[model samples]
Target: MVADFDTIDININVGPQHPSTHGVFRMVLTVDGELVRDLDAVVGYLHRGAEKLLENQDYRQGIGIQDRTEYLAQFPAEQSYVMAAEKLGGFVVPERAEYVRVICVELNRIASHFMFMGAYGTDVGVFGTSFIYGFRERERVYRFFEELTGERMMYSYFRVGGLAWEVMDGFEEKARALLQELKRGINDINGLLTRNEIFIARTRHVGEISAERAIEYGLSGPVLRSTGVRWDVRKDEPYSVYDRFDFDVPVGEFGDCYDRYMVRLEEMRQAVRIVEQALDQMPKSGPIMPEKMPRMLRLPAGEVYVPVESARGEYGVYLVSRGGNHPWRCRVKSPCFTNLQALREMTVGEYVADSVVILGSIDLVLSEVDR
Candidate 1:
């Protein structure tokens, strides 16, 4: 038996300025009542020609450009660029520098996850509590960053073979205290949001994707982890001092928005553990940068690619050197750009409101996408 119902056509432009879009992103949607029939994500409102401009700048100056490409995860952006140059120039980073790199990068990863948790919660009507809580904790971490690097957000602290500056006195103690505070704060936030019936109702079982589909669509980070894959560049392909650190890669049972959220939470805990270990074993005195790194770096004529685990996913840098101070070509493999591809699949049959919620769960920064 079938019941006849009236059908109505509706078309809407969700945003070029919606908060849930995470930036100036527009989505065209065709709907029948509350259900979305079709949607198209319109991007490129934030493009800044970063990759094209890198070819004209020296290796050292080009890092500032990478900072703009993924503003949220600036350390990893600089790391990827420097790693590419290190591989091409055959420079060996000192052991101390490697550990410092790992520590800084992991801390930034925790900060980035906090942002996702906060912003995603707001997008789904959980109010601004999560955002407020997240930023409160994020500020402590950023203070540590400012103490060490002299910049709050875009820190150009990572150089060719080492850091631009050493960790200040009392930095280890501050890091230790912050890690403890973060552990406690994470527990509080988890209890507040992870088990809430309303929160689960909004996120659980939504935007489901299998591990196969995630890989096919080039998804990474929590999006891939949500699909039950334990693949992480830090664990599988060791970089910096990641091989020496003890940590776990959190994987989810189902590929849903809730699972992604949980994976990121667990990952933040793991990052805290790694940071504690680095603090315990940190070298007290050493040169932050390599002794022999040339002021004007010139690489052998060749191309090399270096992949690093950023907060979002595996960010890779492709560099072509023509035996000059400037690179002949540069290309950044931004995770947000590829991760956004799965959005259509995630939102196709869901309600209009769920579209924004699912998009936030994926956590794509427009700068990274537009780069």
Candidate 2:
């Protein structure tokens, strides 16, 4: 009844700039009818040689470029770069600054996840409704960031020792109000998609990666956790003042597209908890930077890597200092790149259209992946 396996196999190229591939990404698919037999992802179209650029600039000047790599969650990228430099320079951030950084980063995490939710829904054919809901909350958060750092999206607010600037009065009140609004917005999203029959049918069993295989592939963030691994860089590594906060890492059991979606959904609630705790515990008075800061920060010769729990996964920075104002070398271990490696593995047995849905579940930022 069925044709010979070789007779139906056909090769198709997806995209290096199409919308569904999520940003300047290409994939070569070997398919038999609609079923994908193989997949090869091509990344780097968004590459701008970010690591080489960082090596050429002064430590302070590199923050702007770090933003370009992860436009959605620039605060964490800034944090990773600055924290690495701080370790080399022996700098201490003020108590207030640490609290501020955590709050801002968590808010940015919420924003990034919103971007994923919107995009993922579209991939599943919900079209503009989910995207509209997602951007509504994101725009609200972006407005707050604009007031705080003077940039809505690409904020270089984190500095080598602390924050770029201090918060204005009434900051706590404003953040609390935002938190309340976020709770309602998340509830609306859950009601719309969590139990939707079509959504479940399309995603429940698609793109499964076993826990062992996920770990073998070196995956992190929701993609890895969707396989039931309870690893989180924040809880396990406890960088910055994350240890002071009480939060739970959400894990998934199915290792499927639906589980990945649910994991990030629950993670948003955890982020809200972290932000609330930070506001309650943050000190009111302290200098953000160390006393009498030097005009130019020169680091001692050394190498250090700082790993932070970014919205996507373990976004890490490796810095090599040469006792100069500029770093000898800088490398970003982007979670998108590591996670994207598992794409072919996830898509091999799925339908071609489902391949797009699986890619959306990974929530990649191509600039970071290609960098």
Judge candidate 1 at residue 324 and give its lDDT. 91
lDDT of 1 at 70: 90
Model 2 regions more than 4 Å off: 1-6
List, residue by residue over 260-308, the lDDT tens digit for candidate 1.
9999999999999898888778787788787877888888999998999
Question: What would the per-residue lDDT of candidate 2 be over residues 221-336, giving only the tens digit for each residue?
Answer: 99999999999999999988999999999999989999999999999999999999999999978888877778788899999999988999989999998888999999999998
TM-score of 2: 0.98
Q: Once model 1 is optimally superposed onto the true structure by TM-score, how far is the C-alpha of residue 298 displaced, in angstroms?
A: 1.2
Best by TM-score: 2
Best by lDDT: 2
